[model samples]
Target: MSNKKKERKLAKKLLHKYRLVILNEDTFEERFAIKLTRLNVFVLTSISAILLIILTTLLIAFTPLREYIPGYASTSLKRKANELNTKTDSLQKAMLMNERYLASIKSVLTGEVKTEDFNRDSILKAARQDIDFSQVLPNRQDSLLREKVDKEDKYNLFEDNNTANFVLFPPVNGAISEAYNLEEKHYAVDIVVPVDTPVKATADGTVIFAEWTMETGYVMIIEHSQELISVYKHNASLTKTQGDLVKAGEVIAMAGNSGQFSTGPHLHFELWSKGYPVNPTNFIDFE
Candidate 1:
């Protein structure tokens, strides 16, 4: 019974009303008045606080004003960062490709490439499959001319030219002082010429090496198309340098007895095809 009485007392206090008034101080006249219960005031205050918290959360989550907060990245900054990442990737790929290209060039220059004998007959046979052989008949003169051409081309190495628009130019007009002898390990032909004779490029190519060596003296190496490389040694001086572009018959060096192995003024010319040394007389007439 005592507990019930205490509970009733507490409820009465919670529901008790209070009068609030606004007054004219001098006249003591009531201008405004309101009656509010304790429970009503508490409920209204709690509701207002919750509403204010929800509004603050919404502003921060949905508006750009959230950028003012710490540890938040701006939208523009994120976009720029992504763009820079893409550019970096592209630059890396380009750099890798350039490196590979340079490696291939270096291998060719250093004679480190593997040798492969290209089968011209097989390639020509495959290419001839598309040709129409019954286009026309040849006259008696044409047959004679064809026979003459066939005889002339029988021993010519480059007669069935594989590379398009490719032709070799003789480096110099001189007699062969020392012919290429594979049995004696002599891989180059010694062309006997007067000192300071101009050595011309054999084909359109880029100069990859132009320098002096103890055994070969001043040497110039040119890289031509169709896996052909020409080397000129025992030079008095070089007219072209590395990385230079030269056309066929362009003067590249001067012939002289400049090396330790040279016996007289001459040009030591070497031809390499697909990393293997080839006889220059096969493709060029040095009579």
Candidate 2:
């Protein structure tokens, strides 16, 4: 019975009404007045607080202001990060391929390549085996064009060579011990000379490679203009280091029979054009 009486009393206090009034301070006049219950005031304040909280949450979630908060990332920033990751992967793959290519070139320069017994001409001929050469004939227009071109070139003295203005110099003057033979896979000419003979550069270029190896002894490679490259092997000593600029006919090394492949004191010289081995005798007159 006592608990029921206390509950009734609390309800009466919560339902009780109070008058709130505002008056002019000097005139003592009642300007505003309102009758409000305790329950009504509490309900109104609670509703206003809830509405303010919801508005604040919507503003942060639906607008760009969210990105300024901690642990929030912008959309454009994520896209740029993904693009950079893709580019980094591509660059890594390209760098790996370049390293492999450089390793192959190093092996060739060090004389670590294995000789193959196939002829390049034979392979090309085999590829054309199905074609009938007798059936192939030049048409009238083609023949006329060829004749006109020949006539124009017949009297022309200034023929444009693809080597630009570069002239090749003989590295050493000696009897050829071994000529370049495609069938034997010997792409370089071996010039027999006494040990410690001076080996000169063939053209104006920069030394790209200079090192010693077990199979080729002291080897030096130069990169020239016009897509030309010259290689000197079986050298007794190299006078210039890699990245050194050299002139035509400059002494770069001394020839010696210092490698496992050397028969005697000779300079194994090779010339390359556009990455293919070319006959050195075709460019420079050694004798």
lDDT of each: 0.84, 0.86
The list of candidate 2 runs beyond 4 A from truth reads: 1-98, 110-164
Report each candidate's C-alpha RMSD, comma-separated, in the order given: 11.4, 11.4
Tens digits of per-residue lDDT for model 1, 172-238: 9889999987666566788899999999999999998888877768888899887788888899999
| Segments in model 1 whose C-alpha atoms lie over 4 Å from true places | 1-165
Worst 10 residues of 1 by lDDT: 106-115
Q: What tens-digit string does per-residue lDDT give for candidate 2 at 94-125? A: 99998997796686575354655789998889
Q: Rate residue 116 of model 2 by lDDT.
A: 57
Model 1 lDDT, full chain set? 0.84
Q: What is the lDDT of residue 34 in candidate 1?
A: 97
